[model samples]
Target: MPSLPEELKDLESKLQHTLRKLESIQKALDESTIVVITDQTGKITYVNEAFCRISQYSREELIGNTHRIVNSGYHSREFFKHMWKTIGTGKIWRGEIKNKAKDGSYYWVQSTIVPFLDERGKPYQYVSIRTDITRLKQYEEQIKYMANHDDLTGLPNRRFLREQFSKLLKETKEEERLLAVYFIDLARFKNINDSLGHSVGDEVLKQMAARFRTVLDQKLFLTRVGGDEFVAVAPRVNYQSILAYVRTIQQMLARPLEIEGREFILSANIGISVFPFDGEDLDTLLSHADMALYHAKEEGKFYQFYHRTINQRLIRETILESHLHRAIERDEFILYYQPQYDLFTGELIRLEALIRWYNSELGWIRPDQFIPLAEKIGLMPKLDEWVLSTACRHRKMWKQRGGVEADLSINLSASHFQIPGMAKRLLSIIESNGDDPCRWEFEVTEHIMMQDSAVVYENISQLKEAGVKLAIDDFGVGYSSLGYIKKLKVDRLKIDRSFIKNLPQSADDQAIVAAVITMARQLAIDIIAEGIENETQIQLLKEMGCKGGQGYFWSPPISETEIELLLHGAE
Candidate 1:
């Protein structure tokens, strides 16, 4: 055992070490934590400087007050009850809490409560320790906001849209009301995006969202799901009124928007599905709306409402698209030649090769029925190649039979014409089939203007340089193409059949026919009037200086055998 002086020295060192540790801990608590001590009855007895600083309270004012002085009312009574119960049992409790400042501002805290017990294990005092986490909570809320909103447009995103839709759907069902889910996509948005930069596109979307907000009011909910698509949900409305309101909204949307001095006319294709009629659930409603939107795009209509038949239409289209893949392999296609006659000389000028499909399952399908579908399904290139090869072979066959030879005019689908190296491919097909380039011609509709103009000009120039003739079919139908016709250098312009169906009996038709002929002459482009069914219409076309004509008056599109017979008759 050590002497008395040694024991006293050791006790002094231990006491000094404990005092230094307590000082360090007190400093740490003051810097980072808000410390407060209260009696077991919950009256505040003391508060550290950190608590007074954070709560905007003086130590004197907080000393006798309970935590209710800074109550935010954010927590329920049960929360405080449970917290009190734990502390009363000589246990610890921890949780995140919101508190009010003396200035009525809100602050967040990570809080813990400790019970100090007496010799009997009964709580005598309660110590509450809290860390100010207001800034951290703010950051967390900001992250949550970004996750639910579109960054570019600052609109509620798909996730938030679905959540709000769920709540609205429940209420709508209880009210026996209807809800419309509108799926909208811009029509020429892709072309605009490709032509202009994405910045301009973003500006357009922002302005569009602002415009939508004006028309939406409080009843309609709008969200920019993504890209050039948006969704609007309107609840507690009937069908007809909803449709009318939607139309007004569309009219507002269609108004031209000017960005950086450039004007853009945006058109939207809208699809609407009503709850309790189209679907009882969100997924089913959205799918039906998407199908309706697809139908609107396909039919060139601005909007469509979901109906039972819409699904059937999609089914038939899908089946048609599938059949088109195997069409060439199964030899389901045939070419019918429509004769173009010289209006003045009454002589056969040429026959336009038109494709007709006779599906084994669904009899003969019209070109109007399957041609656009084929293009949409990405079968145009293959379909056009087959037509070119078949037409070239048929022309060679007709010539070999000692038949009168004229150019077999073939109509080119817009998709095939706009493809790069189209001229080279056609020349190769012509050479392979042993057909003369000068005796064959290609025709395109006015839709070619939508393609890259420079590319089109180059392709057409190359084709013309190789002795291949070109024509613009369905003239005067497309309003924008007529002014730019000189760029194409087409050899012939075919008057659309709509103008001729009314014929000389319709004064508008007569004037249009006369004007088209004059325009054709001025541009050195030969004009052909189609859909002629009577001699009166023929006389009117001739008088208008229309150079060539073709329709039922001469002959409907016929087989090679009939054309061969006609060739013999001509000889």
Candidate 2:
């Protein structure tokens, strides 16, 4: 070898420094996230160790191969075309991608691709950096599914329905194809849910959804919009076809469902709306369909086609909902006290406080109408509290005015009972009354008791211990099982009006009433027969050894003044 010049030695030193720097860069790339360099044709030119590990392929196997080796077949041709259009212009493309591994397993990656251009500003090579996000992708998918679907029935939810409707509206061409929207409300679902509990209710809904799915083909979309309510959208169907489908659905729903060794007759109220005829938009179509459903339910338990008249009712309901909150604040509610008499003594014993809503514009709105709306809107707890406190205050006033010794009975809704601190609130009201806790009776229906026995038992037990008498209202009509009655610590059993109305004629009704009375006697619980409209029914209940009775036969639900007059007269 010849002796080296000073310039050549300096050049050698610089080359060694550059090699050290390049080695460090390579080592860093190997340890960092997944990085790959591909030629202009997308053939793999370089892959770091992390890339090989993530794809479950060795560097030697991946280096010479094309990127297609990890193809997951999830992306469409259009997707790749658009991606290439952007990156081929020397721009960056960022997206989530699913890729197959060497072992035939699939993994998701959050990928970013940067295209490198030649000196002419044309794409020459592409560099992609990715992070393994398979687990995170799965979690996101799970959350999306939960948000758009019902866990119990595995059906699409209201949110999903709205999205589908929006998509349909965007794609629909006017006068080209018609969309049929069907609103189905289960006829006896609440009754079944009340009698059998929510677990059985959930099973019933699942089976019902399955049955609904079986009757429709791939073109239809079904969603559960609310408890006991379902909506179906059938695409490219005319009015007549939609009506036929509705009839078919009604027939399927009429079939009996066997649950927990009980045969339950299923029925649905269906309402139909046609696109461009009933409504030109999604909201209008859904609104009309719901209106038609209400009409069907009102007319009979079957199907009905949409009509213009139904729209008016929907508008009215919407107005009601909008103004309901203001109605509560405006004190549009009043309490009516119906006197309950002792069957043996023929003396007024207690006055049951019934809520009545008197709207200035709508006049006297029936409790049946607004009470359920209140429960649905989550206002029942507040209403119940107001009723309790007001009735207690009224009872105190009546006692001070030389009225007969009478307690106040307030009806408690199932929703009200489910609220946390309900027992404490009741106790506080009773304590504030300055009266015997036993004098304040709380009337709860048997349906409410069957919902969650453990929670209901705990709350009722607390109320009972605090001196509030617990009475099971509408007793014989619901699932009045002995187990629940015993577990509930009940002080009174008020027979439902349906049995009382039949009285001596129907043998089955007589048997049911007699059985309930016998059970109450055996359990040492007092019995009160409500809805006693006739002398014959009253006499029959008295003969049956019922303890207390109240109905129109005594007097319709009266105001506090009227009840006071009745009590003083009885005294």
Question: Who wins the TM-score comparison?
Answer: 1
lDDT, candidate 2, at 501: 85
Where in model 2 is the C-alpha error above 4 Å?
Answer: 1-178, 183-215, 221-231, 238-240, 243-271, 291-305, 308-310
Residues 1-571 of candidate 2 have per-residue lDDT tens digits of 5557977998999999999999898788777678999999888999888788878898888887887899999999999999889999999999988999989999998889999999999989999988889999999999999999988888999889887776665555543778888888888688677767998998899889999889876678899888999989887766677777877786787788888898777877888888878987778888888888888877674877788877777677677777677876898888998878888788788889999988888888778778777777888888888898878877777778887878789999876776667798778876777767778888987778547645666777788888888888888766767877777778899988888888889889988888889889999999999888877887787788887999998888888888777767766
Error of 1 at 46 (Å): 4.1
TM-score of 1: 0.90
Per-residue error (Å), model 2, residue 171 = 11
Return the lDDT, model 1, position 315. 90
Question: Residue 225 lDDT in model 1?
Answer: 85
Report every candidate's CA lDDT: 0.87, 0.83
lDDT of 1 by residue, 304-350 (tens): 99998989978987888888889999999999899999989999998
Steric clashes per prediction: 0, 0
What is the TM-score of candidate 2? 0.63
